[model samples]
Target: MTFEVFMQQLANGISIGSLYALLAIGYTMVYGILRLINFAHGDIFMMSAYFMVFGMVTFGLPWYVSAAIVIVAAVALGVLIEKAAYKSLRDAPRMSIMISAIGVSFLLENLATYLFTGVPKGFPDIDILTRAISFGNVSLSVATVVTPVVTIILLFVVLFITNKTKIGMAMRAVSKDFETARLMGININRVISTTFVIGSALAAVGAILWGSKYPSVIPLMGVMPGLKCFIAAVLGGIGNTTGAVLGGFILGMSEIMLVSFLPSLTGYRDAIAFIILIIVLIVKPTGLLGEKVTDKV
Candidate 1:
């Protein structure tokens, strides 16, 4: 491939990787706190996309307005899921919470189908994000260039928040030992709620960026992305946010480069994430940057 072609592909990889990174952060955060996968997280993303569509297309709102609305809706939905489904199950077995998460996922999917009729909706075209632009020899859309930048900025923001803030300290303490943190006067519920709020908001942002690139919305739209992001989280260390971001970039780059180098493997792109997951599990279960955490026996 030519240099320009390589650059284009790199841009594509970064854009998709950024979205994966955003979603993967959500997975890692929740898992770090509760050790639950939050299977419904993907559906929350899908629902956010629909909220965008309705806000922009149905209500004649602007893109920024729609996006704000989507974020608020996603945050609300995430907190609701935590309260209605997860909070009550706090004292229950791990398997029970997992089951609840799965049920919530199904409920969101079905509810979206009932409301949106499963007909794929076109994502509104925002000229600013979708407009074509040139960078030296690289020609791409604004979103392509913006995505990685956004991801990097957000990464720093999240890292700073988790590393510098008081709530972040509480989160770290809780992740290490829930009961101990509570004994230290950390409100477990508040920290968990904050995690969900941040995670779901990130999901909304990812969904908006996804719309810019893919430009189609459907009830099942989030399923594959959700699964892959989860895999990305696992590949990076499920409870480590930075690792999740790193894993996302790796998966995104690998998938795109695979298609670029081996056309025959293009159809097998999705399989790559799973293969990486398997390799990570076998080679390093704690993930590349993951710390080993042992339960007190």
Candidate 2:
């Protein structure tokens, strides 16, 4: 491939990677705190896309305004899901809680299908966002350049909040041991809700960026990204926040470069994740930066 073509492919990979990073953060954070898979998280991402469309078409809002509204609604929905479904299973066995999460995923997917129809909807075109800029011989989408910067900034902000604040400490305690944290005066519900909100907000950002890049919305839209990001979280070490972002970039670029360099591999892109997942499981289950974890007897 030519230098320009390679650069363009790299650019595409970075933009896609940034989206994966954003989505992976949500999955990682939720798992870190609750040890729950949150199968519904992907569908929540899908719902946010529809929410954006609804805000734009039904309420006649500007792109930015509609995007914000959709994010807020998604955040609220995430909290509600935790309260209505996950909360009840907090004291139950891990398997039961995970099953409930899976159920919620199905419920949301079917509900979205019923409400919006299984047909895909096109995202509204915003001229500025779609416009591409040229730098020397390299062509780049404005969204492509902007997406990673935004994602990095958000990652730092989240890291700061989780590392330097009181609530962050409480969240850590809860993640370590919910019952002990509760006994130590941390309000379980409040911390859990905050975790859900933050995770959901990140998912919304991913949804918006993904919708912008792909320009299509559907009930199952989040499935692939969600699953990929989930794998990324695992690859980076499930409970490690920073690892998730790094893993996301790796997965995103790998997928893109695979298709770019090996055009014949286009049809096997999804399988690549499964293969990587299996390799990671066998080779370095703790991930690149993951620490060895042990269960107390």
Measured against the true structure, the TM-scores of the candidates, in listed sequence, are 0.98, 0.97
Model 2 per-residue lDDT tens digits across residues 66-119: 888988999999999999999988988889999999899989989999999999
Model 2 residue runs over 4 Å out of place are 295-297
* Whole-model Cα lDDT of every candidate shown, in order: 0.93, 0.88
What tens-digit string does per-residue lDDT give for candidate 1 at 57-117? 9999999989999999999999999999999999788899999999999999999899899
At residue 89, candidate 2 shows an lDDT of 88
Cα lDDT over the full model 2: 0.88
